[model samples]
Target: MKYLSICYIGFISLIFISGGLFIMSINFLLIDFSLFIEWEVVSLNSMSIVMAFLFDWMSLMFMSIVLLISSLVIYYSMEYMSEDKKINRFIMLVLMFVLSMMLLIISPNLISILLGWDGLGLVSYCLVIYFQNIKSYNAGMLTALSNRIGDVALLLAIAWMLNYGSWNYIFYIEMQKMDMEMFIIGGLITLAAMTKSAQIPFSAWLPAAMAAPTPVSALVHSSTLVTAGVYLLIRFNILLADTYLGQFLLFISGLTMFMAGLGANFEFDLKKIIALSTLSQLGLMMSILSMGFYKLAFFHLLAHAFFKALLFMCAGAIIHNMNDNQDIRMMGGLCVHMPMTSSCLNVANLALCGMPFLAGFYSKDLILETVSMSYINMFSFFLFFFSTGLTVCYSLRLVYYTMTGDLNCSSLNVLNDEGWIMLKGMLGLLVMSVLGGCMLNWLIFLTPSMICLPIYLKLLTLFVCLMGGMVGYFVSYVNLFFFNKSLYNNKIVMFIGSMWFMPYLSTYGVIFYPLFLGGYIVKSMDQGWSEYFGSQQLYKSLIKYSQINQIVQNNNLKIYLLLFVLWIIILLSLMLLM
Candidate 1:
């Protein structure tokens, strides 16, 4: 069974090698190979929907990261999901997801990308519902439905591209400059990306998706599934730059970043907190991409994949030790009992908070510096800085609750660092989380992002990071002078913690009105007038008419004889008149 994890790692190594080969030949790597199977043509427009594979730096780099994170996740799952009887099935599903992601990465044609896109949606649904519990079922439905919106949006994009006589969006991206139809298509693509990435209204699904196994969370949320949307937008960035749709996405993504950061501060569930952080990072990637820094966004996406996956694996280790408890309140003194796990958690957390020289610093610092150099409005600027601080705020609080305090659990609670398999899985990511950013920064950009600004503007991120860390540590970790109170009890805290009631909005708010209207329509049309006027009334009226005619024809011999005499008299009178 342990060999299985090794086998997967070996496969990932092969992929890494292949990607390295392409990386070496970067000069000749501008290759697009379309394999046409010559399937029966369905349209008169001569649309040859072929299987296309695009090999370039972007696709290859992204593929390497995906496989790297996936291998670690699979190895982690060997121990994380060890108790499950269907571990084989779980591993296979994960492989399917990775394969689908690869398909998505290599496909330049919109029509063929559907295969990968649809594969992602379906396999994710399967993984989400793998637990087969009520919570998993609900979360799976939300995940599926949210992604279905993107699927439909993609379909609309395909329909719009029909007028261009080709489904290869890459080829048309340049010609679409200043085209109104292209703008609309770009807007639809943005909408699709938004939903898939869980921006704003579609965000509830990300946290809810924690109902899945932690390994699934690590892979899907970190490297593969959620990033798919940002990747899509990155691929289509040329068409979207300076477009109205890009501006709209920029605003929304900024808001999402702010909202998620605030929400994370208010959260108590450990996994959900990390999940929210992932959401915040996603928003960051999306916002940067919207700002026309596709390379920066891609770099961050790769770096985030490393540490974020490591972060989830650490969370899983803690949860496994804590008897499946996800609440931070129930955890304490873990640093003493499980030094290895605690160290990894701290490292990942620091990297996430953009600590200097770590993986995140390379990409995150660049993003902030780039933002500071841009000409964004005050609101967007404030959101970026405030969200950066909020990140550290929640992170520090998490550290306090989990790693720093006295033992908060009962005497019977058992905690240990005995999960060697899981530890082995995490160790790989721990190294990557430490060095992945630097390596990616060097390889991808080949140079630093040049920015010259006022000292105050330059140090803005550092200031926020320090301030957030101080506040977080002071309020949560320090219990000597001040009494610690639960922010969850406050009305404002509840609002922000509940993600501005976005869960309710995306779930009940979205479904309630439509459901109410549907019920009304059913009552009024299906059960009321349509039934009465269509089938019920018509049948009743025919029955009544039949009854009346039957009564008239039955016991009326004198009436019949009088009618017969009148008819004969009328016939004779007509003949005489003629």
Candidate 2:
């Protein structure tokens, strides 16, 4: 609570405003940043903060992605959230969410970075339960609780680094000097990432997070929050390049990919399906990350961010127009009715399906190619092979359910793409989703491996896509012939999916079973925040505490002064003790 201050908040917003325009300005800003190339001078310049913050193309690009999605979420919330009575607070919280993310992206020291990292975990959980009075909290609760398990692991990893080897992140630039404890810590960090990113057993929270606001669903689940775990892995990738733990992470990642794709195939809700898609893609990225291909993983991150956000928004628009309806069974024949939104959804879907000219193809295909260089690439190759069809199948399901068939029976509100704000954001994102992937050089600082796959691989991927589409079409055709509950239950496919249960089978499992675990989380959260805020209100009312309210609400000078004193003592103590 004390952490929320105006200057801090404003500084974050400006960072977002600046970070949002990151990619657009990166190539152009090289000269502006070139003068600070010397690390000593950069450190001196950073003396203002103690840890010299030097700018790099990679960090800048990451900041922009964080800002761009966050700003758009805020901008879109104007329409999506404006009518809600709590809109102002929601907007403020949203900004805080992004600001924390910005802090994590740019920090030079591990301690500095972890401050932002933990902030993301807390803020994201708050946003997950933003709509305090719904079943959505169940999903939000699950995400919050599961992410915390990962958070605890991450803390241990960070603490281990700080206490042993005199290793500060400032020295990460010199990797060869790190000790055995560093390698051990690196493994723990991957465990943390696996939990954070919804990598396998953790995959369930993402689908459950569908309970949050649609915009949050887009911003957190798709573009940012979920990706932070993977982003952490990428940022620290080179530091742990040759460690065995890194290879162990690759195994977790590969299994997560298969699990996510399978689960999405059977999922029926529009948003959850896309949410599951995010898990699958993150798994693919992690797999690439484990193999030490940072560029491929990061490129997949960018490409997935655009298309995935587009997918989530498309889900939101459908849900919004239907008056909070999310079950696909409740929607149909919407294409002709909501032309603009359906159009945008279609464009994003095309990119997601890796339609050749769209943004997703360039990045996703390159990831597949790069992984194929090693033995494990076979896992990616086949997982994607099946995923190609699953992606097309589930994606087409959203379009099919919303627009293609006769409208289903769920009572719907009068469909309206009423607000220009939502429309403008969707249209703009559609453009970016289509074109953003082609801007590859800026995709990663590293050059990509050339595609050396035999011509048959392209043919194989196409065959996979066609078969998935045909299977879906055939299934749809069979549905008309005879409706049977058993057919909808594909046991063989489910069995293959059980292979992913390796993490789950351990006596102490990483994957929490039962989606309901997340729901209880929501009820607990509401109780806690309610207790905290209610007590604050009661204290103010009884004590003639206007000054207290002013301090809490105004958030200017006094709080920052307190923070300054607190940090002074902490840092001074650290210097003395160490």
Candidate achieving the largest lDDT: 1
* lDDT of predicted model 2: 0.69
Give lDDT tens digits, candidate 2, residues 1-578. 22224324543575456555574447635544421122332434435324435356666777676676666666666667766877667767777777777776666556656777778778777877887866656656666777777778877877777655443554553554356766667767777788778776676666667777888888886556778788777767865455576667777777777677666655567887787778778877887787788877878787788777877777777777887777887877777678888888888887877778788888766666665556664555576567666777666655665677777855646876776878876876788787888874444544434667788775676676667766665565455543365456557545544434432442124334433566666666655666567886687676777777667677788788987999999999999999
Off by over 4 Å in 2: 1-16, 19-25, 28-54, 134-137, 163-167, 239-243, 377-380, 410-412, 441-449, 480-578
- Which 10 consecutive residues of model 2 have the lowest summed lDDT? 34-43
lDDT of 2 at 182: 61
Model 1, position 354: C-alpha lDDT score: 96
For residues 293-341, what per-residue lDDT tens digits would candidate 1 score against the true structure? 9989998998999899999999999989888889998888999999999
Colliding residue pairs in candidate 2: 136-211, 138-518, 138-519, 142-518, 334-402, 334-403, 335-403
Error of 1 at 496 (Å): 0.8
Clashes of each: 0, 7
**How much does each candidate deviate from the true structure in C-alpha RMSD?**
4.2, 15.4
